[model samples]
Target chain A: MSHSYEHPRPALAVDCVVFGLDENGLQVLLVERGVAPFKGRTALPGGFVRLDETLEEAARRELEEETGLGAKVFLEQLYTFGDLHRDPRERVVSVAYYALVKLSDHRVRAATDASAAAWFRLGDKPQLPFDHEQILRVAKARLQAKVRYQPLGFELLPPRFTLAQLQSLYEAVLEKPVDKRNFRKKILSMELLEETGEREEGVSHRAARLYRFDRKRYVALEKAGVNFEL
Target chain B: MSHSYEHPRPALAVDCVVFGLDENGLQVLLVERGVAPFKGRTALPGGFVRLDETLEEAARRELEEETGLGAKVFLEQLYTFGDLHRDPRERVVSVAYYALVKLSDHRVRAATDASAAAWFRLGDKPQLPFDHEQILRVAKARLQAKVRYQPLGFELLPPRFTLAQLQSLYEAVLEKPVDKRNFRKKILSMELLEETGEREEGVSHRAARLYRFDRKRYVALEKAGVNFEL
Candidate 1:
């Protein structure tokens, strides 16, 4: 086959840029490399891509193996970085992905092989290896852009979330304080959220109605040019 | 070096999803593949990545070799596809890029290798090789989305353009008619376009003032979160 006959292929790798929203702000997941080149340095949770697995499969596998994240989490390809010298040793092509998981489900158990895996406040993250710092910047920009058009903020919220939490999610991602009345009007007019008869118990103030993202309705309305803005 | 290990690597390929806007509406650049596996089939302009250069360079080289396009056009990484059976012959991973070029500048010329190269109306493109059709669809969707928030619509037009031409560019890519008054108000409010004291000639009606995209002002405003919505 021409694919195999022409020349040698470059090494392939996968990197994940995981994001979660917390009380302080957005946090990103990073793992300390246990092996060579950048050993002992913090980086996105990722590793080599296997021969048989596709990039998505490799990302999911690495996410699970390194950070104990599972298939149920939301993940999407952000971009690919294939600069020849991105990896000092050889021509390594890294396909980067961005994942959004709820901070409330904060049960991340680092794998044994990795020296350390932890969530760092995005603003306080250590210097990452290779082009990972650039990759994280792209991921944050993507999140900011997506939160306006797509109803992806639900990925970082509990199954039954209150209105205040949803507003906080949008505020955190956009990095700006939004008028509460306008935010509520804009989101509710889209009709992509279902109001459930539930409320939070621990807060001192009167709780708001719990809501869940109506994926089906969102998909249907999205096709008809519905604007899910905040 | 771990990168030097004799591990299996997937063949890297590049695919170009080029967009053009003309009087006939939005069009996409495509070529007829001359080589085997899918000979004589229409496909996106692309080729294999050389070991010496980066993937961006490889993409530019492939685009030039196949379609006679130059390196000055606007190019952005679209996405990466790494499905195992995406290529019929071997494990091939393709990095797709979307390019926007003014239709009046570069004349479409098919090189010796490609059987034919032409621009097809975006909505009337033929079934493409591999997963390129899906890639093209995603590219068009992205273009439509970006033209609203970013100054990308100008890339499809000549350096000097009128308000009507700019509105038409949006209408073409979006596949819908936009209110001229509303579009004009929204775009003018952004203050990213500078009047050039020129007008279109040979027109039966009143010629409109010519304008150019102000890159410096755009950069400043973009950093300020002032979205150029229209």
Candidate 2:
């Protein structure tokens, strides 16, 4: 059976907002466009969807192709942007996705369809082309909102980290100073982190205990629909 | 400048899951397909996207054209499903949306592209065609999870409702018996509802006082990023 339409269909595409964390704060991955309508301007890594791939697959493929990021990073669908004038050359409906990666684990390099790839501090990102600025804003808000009730911040941290590192991550994402005593009390009360019985390797001051997120317990709590308010 | 692709582009579409509540419980609006690719089978009200409208506009248009639903419903984009074989005829990508409406406010009638439209209790719905079943399941889960932290349940009830109605709404959506004392204590603590200075009328039993949702306060709290965890 063949399907044809009397009207022109909008082009389906996928874009990714990749967020990474470092000592400074949260960062976003952007690539210099290799083709027009926004040629030479920096944009999120993305491309048109292909017939053989799912939306997430297309996002991952474009991520790897444009920014040299691997497919194993945590990714989730953010939203679908379909403004009438989003693309000047055509009617393009983009399914946007957000990804979290460990900044220390993978260093990005431009490749394939992109001229250059780099991480920019959240507030210091260059003016984006098309509707990418709005997409990135939405992704940032989703990350901030989700971090309050979900254990998504762990994806941007190392496998084992100190309580101070966790607090720093939360402060960076939430953009506020957390009460040290209350933060520690609430986080420890959740019982979702287990002491690794190891100390920070080389600290100028008294080293804190290293802890690893208990993924199994988190998954069970999530499955049981337990609210994680932090 | 015009754009053309060397390969066939996947067709874009929009589908909406309309949720309503009644004395029986939560209900969903479904329409019987009037065209092929399901023909007479029931499915979510939807159609292909048009170039002139946005994805949400397309969803609202389809809902009205197929199910007699108006444009003022509280609708949100749920997710985009881009499975390769979701549509049997060709490669189709659909952006799914979920809408909430008061059952007492509107009477749905089948029109335009659908053969018939009707409401079915969530658990009593027939086996839907295509991947609509999965979309509906996701919408249900989203509603259930969100009601715990958001004031979305109020959208399904009448303008002036009793605290008992609000509790029933939560109990219905969460599919469990919520403790009365705890539910009242927590809900009142949020300070999101105000007395309407009216009592329920025309009831055989005791007429309880009516309350209305505090939309202004809710909007303010939402802007301030307050967590309404219940």
> What DockQ values do the models have?
0.45, 0.47
Summarize candidate 2's per-residue lDDT along A23-93 as a digit string, tens digits.
98999889888888888898998999999999999999998888888889999999999999999888999
> Residues B3-77, candidate 2, lDDT per residue (tens digit)?
345656898999999999888889998888889999999899999998899999999999888878889889999
Q: Note the Cα lDDT for every prediction shown.
A: 0.85, 0.89
The prediction achieving the highest lDDT against the true structure is: 2
lDDT of 1 by residue, B129-216 (tens): 7989789888988898888778898889999999999998888888899999999888988898999999989999999999999989
- Distance from true location, Cα of A72 in model 1, Å: 0.6
| Tens-digit lDDT string for candidate 1 (A123-224) | 898999898988999999999988887889999988989888889888889889989998898888888889888888888988778998899998898788
Pairs that collide, model 2: none
Lowest summed lDDT over 10 consecutive residues: which window, candidate 1 chain B?
A: B106-115
TM-score, prediction 2: 0.92
